[model samples]
Target chain A: MIDPSGWDLPSLTDRWRSATPFGHVAIDDLVARAALDELRQGVSKEPHWPNRGEIFEMMASGPPQQPTPRAFLEALGGPAVRDALAAITGYRLQRVDGNSYVYLAGSYLLPHTDHRPGVDRRIAYVYYLSPEGAFTGGELDLYRCTTDGSGDIVATEIAATLAPRPNRLLLFDVGLTTLHQVREVTGGARISLAGWFY
Target chain B: MLALHRDVLSTDERAQLRATLDAAGWSAHDLADRLHLATANAGADDALFARLLDLANRTTRPLRLRAFQWLRLRRGDYQLLKHDARERPPAAHVELIVDLSAAATGEAELVYTDGGATLFYVPQLPGSVAVIERPPALLRYQRYLCLRVADAEVHRLRLTLA
Candidate 1:
């Protein structure tokens, strides 16, 4: 059974609708045991070859590349999350692509946008899996892009960040107005599942 | 801002061009000339040039509706270069990584550059996504973080192509 406790879906839908540049709806305890077990088994495994600039950092490149499978991604953006997305946009959702990253202590992620040019990205969903007390200082920053020229306040927008919440998922539109990046993980490992919806 | 040129380049292509422009110190006039040439030889010269010119004009205009199409496509790199040129730093180049365990706890660092070598983070970099802040207690009900930096500085670094 799915629980909507602590979440006001109706209000969240409105938030998504009224969001500037981009908006996000978050899920708590998104990672269930079944999902985590599947993810653990699939660690270090690579998905099919990503098209162009689709693949960023390679987990397999690290000291030990774990085996991650399609099931892992599906678990990250599971039925519950998809249902929420469908409710928000009134459209069925599909997983465009998914990837994962692992950060050890003292490691940091340079700030950057996810989807590249010419890519057909619609929505982006991210799930954080940092072990409790295992690390510190990893956060996702979402920026609202605006233009201020001369003495005029021509344009304004909103940008929000979601901290590293264990078993939490964040869903948002990946449009131009949605400018986001991840901050470096300071002390421990920060694992995440990020991909887009077409 | 400029109007949506009927012949505005594809969103992806436009984004690529914008990233290139940001890195190369190119201008609208330069982009306009290139757009003209790119569309001129594509066989539908008039329609394409008209669109390009429209885009240039609309983007130059203040309102975002004029550039909504590109915006929908998430052409932020271009939008920043064309529109937010003068905004100062606090802007950042963030690269997100998912750990092998698929967790959100890990160590990461910011590396700045100036067309030469990937420079180290400096207080003098003009702008940077320097720090992360804790959310207000009222908002702690959810997981989230915010970055601080000058908007101008984020654009100042210009993207370095692969």
Candidate 2:
């Protein structure tokens, strides 16, 4: 569960607006300490499958079937959290859907934008649940893109690298310029809950 | 299906081909969601083409060379499934990929997939050639070259027979 009193909505909104290379913000300790353990336990119990392709290789779980994790997902899509996120990013997010992900050693995701025409995805988010000091080299990398007159990406360069620190939440705009990737996990596993708000 | 032929070229022959390809000009293809690598068109090599044709004919019906190219993937390069060409001749075809790297890194590989399921894999082994049947729905892509393998470079010669 989230603790609204701990959040400074005005400051988060400012940060989101001023962020570079397309809008994004990272919030640490987003979840209430008392509920964190239950959430992690529920996620760990879910079944996962190895999803591999040319651009990515990682373990992904479907929508949580357990009551605790399912309830947490419902809370995320509920009006309170949705309004808070809307205030920060200025996007009218109606609902959210997410799945658990595990990036083990040698796993990676190459650069890509989460944009798709007519998909209606407005914002993307990742909630890091990995244990402290459990992994190395699995950073979320954002890229700065240069687009041509026709609005096609012509070039790109790294703009930011965000560590998957436990209990941190990363939110970014979903658009053509928001190119990003998950760097390869060289050591232990990197676990997280990631999804998009529509 | 996939078949691998080891030591298809002699050491000296492979080295000569590598040297020639190394000297040719290459253009970068940098589409983020699709691919990021260097590609070049090599000069016509009638002898090599004939040899590849003969090799492919052993397993498949008689075919003719349709196209060929050189690919170079350095560290941090990749080719995603979306980049595979969708336009192809209606008849069944085969693809031949000859590895020419100085040494095999084993990180980069060619994978063929259909409906999200992997059908075959081609490892990166120098002096080896992979022959793969190309059906209309089959898609192939080269895996990403990770940066952990310092100075890793993968050079391959790809030929299309239809």
lDDT of candidates 1 onward, in order: 0.41, 0.85
The sequence of per-residue lDDT tens digits that candidate 1 reaches over residues A27-135 is: 7775466666556455535332322111122232222234444555554356775676777766587654666667554333333345568976767877675556766
lDDT of 1 by residue, B70-124 (tens): 1110111112212222321233311111011111121112223332343332221
lDDT of 2 by residue, B1-162 (tens): 788999987778878887787677778888776788998656867898898889999967788889888888997788877667533455568989998877889678888888488888899998888888988888888888775556977888888898
Write model 2 residue lDDT over A125-158, tens digit each, in one string.
Answer: 8999888999998898888888889987667788
Q: After best superposition, candidate 1 residue A20: deviation in angstroms?
A: 5.4
Report the TM-score measured on chain A for model 1: 0.69
- TM-score on alpha carbons, each prediction: 0.45, 0.84
